[model samples]
Target: MLEFRDVDTFYGELHVLKAVNYKIEQGEIVCLLGGNACGKSTTMKTVLGVVQPKRGAVVLEGEDISRLSTAERVRRGIAPVPEARRLFPRMTVYENLMMGAYTRKDKAAIAEDLERVYELFPRVKERLAQSAGTLSGGEQQMVAMGRALMARPRLLCMDEPSMGLSPAYVEQVFEIIQEINRQGTTIFVVEQNANMALSIAHRGYVLQTGEVMLHGTASELLGNEWLQKVYLGQAEATPAPR
Candidate 1:
């Protein structure tokens, strides 16, 4: 449902994403894996229109959305669960979720979506009146996911969903991600945790120094010696051809 066609992005003179290309098909979970500063997050920003490509296009469905505003992208069915779960600290959990529906006017539908979110995250529903900042890391992440769902996104872009949390929470989150995909929303995840990301992802891409070095099905990536040695911490594995 989304495609990055030969995209290049820059931060002034420092090039970040170099000729990056990938496609996330509808109803698929595609994961992008890379080390620090390798343009994984930049890919998410480009999709959200927070970072425009200097070359090529960011296509959603069949249209080029390279020049669209972030809000316009949201209206066109993109919702983000940001890297740090950047929630409004002072806002109540319910209020934070409502912000995701800011671009909509249909109250009935919004209410129904809210109920769906509550069903997915009963903890969030229970803490509807609590300040978002007071929640634990796992709780905050759940709130973040719920908020994005409030937008009824066709493609959910998650940046570092496993960044901070205990192992149990990490497993829970990935399970929820799989459940979310099973329920029919396409997902494009940018993550550093290669094992967990690839475990649940249908397909995966590896980026190195701003370029795609490997692209394959999740199991193929898992069996790749080079990927295992580099990202999965299997130092004894031999390198494999890209």
Candidate 2:
């Protein structure tokens, strides 16, 4: 489980996150939804320690990791499938997956996890020897997710997993995410596609200008007319759930 407690972060003089707070329970898929510049990706970076918080804490399970290094965070069971599928372009699919286990020392366990990833993304298995850059966008995204899974993270933080994918691929990605959660890894996904994200999420949070404006069970958010208009692109606007 992971929680962001009263976190405040800034980029030089500009404050980007304002007391942002949320929690992802174990075995749950929680989605953070917001428009561009709403600090969705920044939240992921803060959790990963790519950018330290000016105040507050990023707690994993019960330990405060706000001051931990990015590598330490990964070693402590936080792995990311970043937006835009940031993969090693020149690396073969198998090699890229091997990079995810850099923090682990068990070669046997690493090899087992590689097979597990292949099972999850069969397309990746088929392209094991192919260069990552040569794969299709969807295939590359699968590699990114597979690479993160190789780390054996307790909490997998995905930033905009659906960005730039076709609708069919987006649906496929969400299905895989749900399956991954069913297998016991907690997922904290920051997504712009509210409908797709919330469809597979247990709970959802809405962010606006770096503030948490609404949050609730996925069903509650889906039915809320206000969220439907503001983020879900529906015609009616109802009172937002608190």
Candidate 3:
């Protein structure tokens, strides 16, 4: 549903994404995995139109949206749960959710989507009137996901959704991500947690120093000796199906 073709991005003279090419098929969950400074987050920003590619295109469906505004991208069905879940700290949970639908005019549909978000995140429902800043890390992440869903996106882009949470919370968040995919929204997530991310991904790509080093089915990557040694920290251990 989304494609990045020969994308080369930079921050002034500092080259970041290097000829990056990948595709996120419709109704599938794809993940980009790497450690810090691997250009994973930059790929997400490129998709959201926050960082334009100096070369190549960002295609949604069949059209090139590389030059489109962020709001236009959102309207075209790209909703992102950005790194750090940048919520409106002072706004109540409900109000923050409302802001997600700012691009829409259909009140009835917006209300329905709100209820749908509440259904997916009961904790968010419970904290409807609470300030977003007061919520726990896990709760705030839920609020972020719920808010993104409010936009009714066809493709959801999440950057490090498992960051800064307890192990239990991380598991819960990955499970929620799977559920979201099962509900038919395509997902493209960039993560450092390879084990957790690949456990739920339909396919995975390994990025290193702004380039794709490997790409394959999730199970194939999970079983790769190099992948295990470098990312999973299981050198000399046999690969087992997750």
Q: Give the lowest summed-lDDT range of ten residues in model 1.
A: 233-242
- The TM-scores of all predictions, comma-separated, are 0.96, 0.96, 0.96
Which residue pairs come into collision in candidate 3? none
lDDT string, candidate 2, 27-49, tens digits: 99999999999999999999999
Q: Which regions of candidate 3 deviate over 4 angstroms?
A: 236-242
State each model's C-alpha RMSD to the native: 3.8, 4.2, 3.9
Clashes of each: 0, 1, 0
> Across residues 1-242, which tens digit of lDDT does each residue of candidate 3 receive?
99999999999998999999999999999999998999999999999999999999999999999999999999999999999999999999999999888798999999999988988898899999999999999999999999999999999999999999999989989999999999999999999999999999999999999999999999999999899999997776667979
> Could you tell me the TM-score of candidate 2?
0.96
Please give the lDDT score for candidate 1.
Answer: 0.95
Residue pairs clashing in model 2 are: 226-238
